[model samples]
Target: MAVTFYINLAYLLGAIAFVWGLRLLSTPDTARRGNILASIGMGLAIIAAMLAPLENTSNNYGWILGGMAVGAGIGWVSARRIQMTAMPQMVSMFNGLGGACAVVLALVEVFQFYGGERTLDSGQLVIVLSTLLIGGVAFTGSLLAFGKLQGLVRDNTLTLPKHNIINQIMLLVLIVMGVMLVIQGQEAGLTMAMIFTVLALIYGFSFVIPIGGADMPVVISLLNSFTGLSAAAAGLIYENNFMLVGGILVGASGTILTVLMCEAMNRSLLNVLIGGFGGGGGSAKGADGDQVAKEVSINDAAIQLYYSNSVMFVPGYGLAVAQAQKVCKEVDDLLEANGVDVKYAIHPVAGRMPGHMNVLLAEADVPYPKLLDLDDANSALPNTDMVVIVGANDVVNPAAYDDPGSPIYGMPVLNVWEAKNVIVLKRSMSTGYAGIQNPLFFHAKNRMLFGDAKDSLNKLVQELKNL
Candidate 1:
């Protein structure tokens, strides 16, 4: 008991460390050290959790230790091997694994209860229900998110014929099943458990499939929250304080991130939940804008940037894909040296995840003071002389301004068209994740400089240096 008290104290200190580390990570320069500190805190928490006694008589410490070793080995290999582009999918898979673990743990407890070896109580039953429901959703939802992000499956929003009605019915049935399981009174409860598990699996996939690809970052954060909540539920069932605290931290952080991301997109969480954007390959049919080829030369682009007094740099997934953040910074430097005031305009959903663009720019050693969020940047775009859009598409589209018929019409944009000159670096005129052409391409003020982002930026850097 004294040992358990000491472990609890250690766990509290570990939680403090985790929170402090995350605060440090919020700043770019300290992010790496923050990550390392958080990792150390997690290690300490794990040790304390392992030392706590299991409530059940069926103790298999050796099996638990073996499983932990195997999991750790796989995690090490995967993290070391995966590419940066695949990071989002890796995150999804990791979330799914956490959910799977919670589900299995809850199931084991339920099994022990039903086998007449352990008594079930109301508190434990609530924990089991919560874990099963949330973890079940997280597991299947995250798997689908992984497939979409990895391009293993089509990024199609697969909505039910009568989605609202169907969803309501499905949810109602699941709730009913959970209530029944809780009240089954110990008479052959295995069937009830199986039924609940199956319902949860179906609900999980169904929940994620209808969401479009453009809103993946929010969905990922939402699923992350679900996984954390599941872990907390499982912790309560097992009476583990560290698990509860850790899970609560994850849930709170993920929820905050999801809200921030939604705001960045000028969207509400309800809109994200009901609208379901970011499926990947396709979405529900919407207005397809006319495409026109309007191209320009690197020299023309350079002249515009060099002469402009104020320039807004808008970034997107393409910027990250090319790993051109450093070269981008170089361009910004050159533009600034020429007396052009430069500020980075970042969209909330820019890149693969929340804070993704910020992460990339931080990697390039861009100052946080120079980065502007959507609202702040949108206001400045009108007075700007040039808007240098690097591989961004739908986010800056003018169609969002006047075309009520367009899918993203009501969605707020960067107001780049308001600038005196818009210089866009692109490989091709392909539509963005929305699968619709951007009308901004045909705007008279916008000039498309066709090429790879890295090559184009490198050339621009060389041209600037020569000048």
Candidate 2:
């Protein structure tokens, strides 16, 4: 009885830590501390579980410790060594591993029930099967997301003809099979469960495949929710309270973020799940229209920035690729010293994942208050004298609002063109992830200063100093 009491106490404490940590993570100031607290909470839960006595359980310290050491070492190394550019892929892969863990746990319960070593009621069977289904989807779906971001999977290979219809059929069949497993209870054999797991995985790959690169931010978050839900299901099967609470928190947060991002894109949840939307269909007479984009030299752009009453810097995936966050920050600092008001306009889907640009800027020690979200930046744009688009593409595209026939039409984009003078820094006239050309480049008020973003930024800084 005392052992049970102690276990419950530890679980309660862990649950509290998780809640507090999550709350802290909502803001920039305390995110690091929150992460540490959550890690500690997880550690406490693992220790309590290890000490808890259970039937037919031989706690092999060597194997368990060895596994823990290896996993921890890999996680630490990967987290430390990974560049901000590849963060989305890393996140996708790690989230998949979490799902894989839930899969293993569910498989153990499934095998035991099928072998007659254990039995469960209909409700319990449903929970076990649910864990398997969601976990399988998360595992393979995340891998596909990772592959897409890493360029290992080509866009042409992502979808089959009429893939949407195929995905719908698979989903319906998976649901029917899950219901059968629940109804059969102990009567269901291992073969049925294995078939269900395989189908779920296939559905997962198909589900993510149709989504375009532009929608990756939302897709990754949704996959995270799937992994959390599977973990919660596993916890329910084992009656572990801390696991349940932590899983619920992760699942709920991930879901909320996904919905919020969809709203930001002015898209419905159904549209996102439907999946054919983001594959950019090249639009004619939009950004690809015959208007010639004007050019600006580094010296000229620097003079414009130096004398501007107010400036807003817009960044995109290009900024991340050039590893120019520090240089970007340095440029902003120089402007600030000259009494030039500077702020950064960050689009919700600026990079490969949500908060990607924010994380990169944060790494360069950029001040939190200087960052302006979509709404705030839009409202402030008209009064701004100069808008510098650094390594940006679709987010600042005028076609989002101008051309209804465009693929990203009606999508909420940064209104950088609303400023008096617009300067775009890019290596070339290439289109963005949405696979659509940007009309903002051809806007009468905008001028393109073509070159490597880092080189241009450095040269601009030199010119600013000379002036």
Candidate 3:
């Protein structure tokens, strides 16, 4: 009785820690601390489980400890070594692993029940099947997403003729199989369950393959939610309170993030899922036919920045691709030193993932307060003396506002053109991920500084120092 009491007490404490940690994760400043607290909570839960009064749990401690050590070592190494650019893919992979774990747990439980004299109740069977189905989908879906983001798989939508019809048929079959398994009960359901799992895995791959690259942020979040719900189902099967609570929190958070991402792009969840939003690399002609963008030299750009009282920086995936966050920060520092009030204008869907630019800038030690969201940045742009666009294209395009027929018509974008003088540093006049030409380049206030982002920033820094 005493051991049981202590174990329950430990679980309660761990639950509190998880709640507190999740609350803290709401803000960027406390995100690291929140992650640590969550890790500690998980550790406490693991310890309590190992120390439970269940039969042979103590004897299995060696196996548990060995597994923990191996997992910790790999996680530590991966966390330290993975670059920020690949962070989204890493997140997808980890989420997939979580789902895979849930699937494995469900399978183990099924095997144990079948091999032994024990029989699973209808409720237990439902939970097991739920976990298996959801986990299977999340595992394969996330892997496909990771492959797309990593460039290992084609980022465009992959569809066969009448793919929608095929998908509908598969979904209906899966539902029918699940219903049949539930009706058949313990004696005759194992085969159905196995078939259900295979079908779920195929559905996952098919579900995500049709989504285009631009919709990945939303897809990733949705898959994360699926994984969390799967974990919750597994927890219900085992009656583990800690897993239940953790899964609920993750599910709720991921759902909210998915909604926010969809809103950022001014897209509906269904539209993203139906695919074909972001694909093709060909550029659209300018509204007034093809026009050459005016160019500016590094010295001239530096002179504009040096003279401006206030400057705003608009960064995009190009900055991340060039690994120029550090150099961008250096430029901010140099501008600040010369008495220019500097700030960053960040779009909600600026980069490939949510908070991608913010994470990169944070790693370069950029102050959190300097980062302004879309609305705030737009408000600041008109009053700013100069806007330095670093490897950004689609986010600053005036077409979002001016062109009613454009694909991204309703999407919010940085109002860099509102500033008095805009210097855009990019390698070329290529369209961004959306594959649309940016009319902002031809705007009277804008001057193109064509080059690699890092090199251009370095040159600007040298010019500033010389001045």
Sort the candidates on lDDT, descending order: 2, 3, 1
Question: Model 1 RMSD to the real structure?
Answer: 3.0
lDDT per prediction? Answer: 0.82, 0.88, 0.84
Model 1 Cα lDDT, one tens digit per residue, 13-112: 8888888888889877788888988888888887877676656577788897998899899999998997666778888999998999899998898788
Clashes of each: 10, 0, 0
**Model 2 regions lying over 4 Å from their true place:** 54-57
Please give the RMSD of candidate 2 to the true structure. 1.4
**Estimated TM-score for each candidate:** 0.91, 0.97, 0.95
The 10 consecutive residues of candidate 2 with the worst lDDT sum are 281-290
What are the per-residue Cα lDDT tens digits for candidate 2 across 1-467? 88888888888888888999999987788999999999888988988888787543676877989999999999999999999989999999999999999989999988989999988888888898888889988999999999999989866476889888998899899889889888877676789889998898888898888888788999999999999999999899999998899899989999999999998888887777664554666662455446898999888899999999899999899999999999988899899999999999999989999899999999989988999999999999999999999888888877878788777778899988789999999999888887888878888899999999998999988898888
Candidate topping lDDT? 2
Q: Residue-wise lDDT of candidate 3 within 1-467, one digit each (tens)?
A: 88888888888888899999999987679989998998899888888877775766347767778988998999899999998778889989998999899999988977776666567887787888889888998999999989988988875546766665777898899888777777777666566667888898888888888787777778888999999899889879878888898888888888999999889778889878874556655343364575778999988999999989999999888888889999989989999998999999988777777778888898999999999999999999999999988877777877777687677777788888788999988898777777788888888888999999999999988999999
How good is model 1 by TM-score?
Answer: 0.91
